[model samples]
Target: MNVFEGSAGYYGRYRPGLPPEAVALLAGAGSPSSRPRRLLDLGTGTGLAVKALLDRFDDIIALDTDVEMLAIAETDLRWRLPAGVRLSLCHGAAEEFLPPPGWRADLVTICRVFRWLDRPAVLARLNQHVAPDGAVAVLADRSLWTATNPWQQAVRSVVQDFLGPQRRAGSGVFPATPEPFGQTLRASAFSDVTESFVPVRRAWSADGVLGYLYSTSFAAPHLFGDRRDHFEAAVRQVLGCFSDTDTFIEDNTFVIHLGRRPA
Candidate 1:
């Protein structure tokens, strides 16, 4: 069950883009002096990170398993790239994607979607494709469902009432990451791992929250089935109870883990 099959519209429209500071941090990691840099972005749903770093890379390969997600990403990046910046959108999973013969990337980035992949295998694949001096950056942040705000709690509770207490991924429940992402990276061929944190504050309207919910696998509109309208109304009511202006703030801590293959 591919949860992102038909949710690309919501994902492209609602999911937050990478913060400017985070983008700068990634760009500043290292730059090759001889030629333009190349980037490979795995699990690039809707291309948020790709869009942010397009200007810095000479060529970019954005890969994802969902066709709809790649379609939306293509549309989003169609006219946004700078002159001479080549873009290739591939449809595939991270575990099995193979770069072109002799291709190597200066940077490989996985954002928000890394937890769903086979970590060790993906890292191994990246190690083969990344330049010796290049790095792999995994970006992740706490979910809105885990926020401690009253409104966030109420909204999550309503979702639980409609769905269940556990998080849903397609037809199955999502499992917690087997171990800390850093630990997994360290255990892989990428042994030089470092981390950085960026605190982000955002305000969301009720509609924004609904859009965000629709973008995620766990509280998607399809989960409600025939009760989708009821679920929306209930969520609106819960949010309204706390937000007079129908806007709620989310304080998130975004983390980036950089992994480099030992020289």
Candidate 2:
């Protein structure tokens, strides 16, 4: 069963892509100069990160658990692919993905989808597949639930009033604080782990916030069931109180965690 069943449209439209600086950091960690460079993007939601680094790799395979997401991601990247670069999309979860026989990935990237996966198991499996000198880079950013801005807090209150105090993520509840990504990489088979941060500012209109909420696992439209309309009305009311124009700002940081094969 697809957990993010109806979210493809909202996700493709509202989820922000990685900033160029973060993309550059990831690109630098890859083996671009090596011939037949390969990129394996696990959980490639909308192919956002892969789109940024398209030209850096010769062969790319994007994997995702949601079929609809793969469709959107494919449409986004297929036309932009450079000559001699190959792109393939597979529907599978990271924990179940196995590298093709004797084939190794020059770089393996896991973006926002890491928290939904079995962290230790995924890293352990990547040990056998990532190129000798290549890296496994995982990225994540703050969600509105963690934002500190006044308007954001108000919005959260409205969501909680509708969905209860606990956060719902698909079939399970979201962790109040999941273990840090960097710490997980450090304990894996890979070595020379390092962490970096990219500060980002996000601007949102009331409508934009509504669309983004629908795109998230915890606040997906399905979670609201028949009350989605009522929830949206409450969110807009709260947003209106905070800003007559319905504009909001979020100061967020993208955290990148990189681990590499042992030399």
lDDT of each: 0.86, 0.85
What's the TM-score of every candidate structure? 0.97, 0.94
* RMSD in order of candidates: 1.2, 1.5
Worst 10 residues of 1 by lDDT: 28-37
Q: State which candidate has the highest TM-score.
A: 1
lDDT of 2: 0.85
After TM-score superposition, what is the CA distance of residue 203 in candidate 2 from its true location, in Å? 1.2
Candidate with top lDDT is 1
How well is each residue in 46-162 modelled by candidate 1, as lDDT tens digits? 999999998888889999988888888999997999999989999998999898898888888998788889989999888788888888898888776777777888988998898
Per-residue lDDT of model 2, residues 80-142, tens digit only: 999999898999878888877877888899997888789899988888887887889998888
Rate residue 113 of model 2 by lDDT.
84
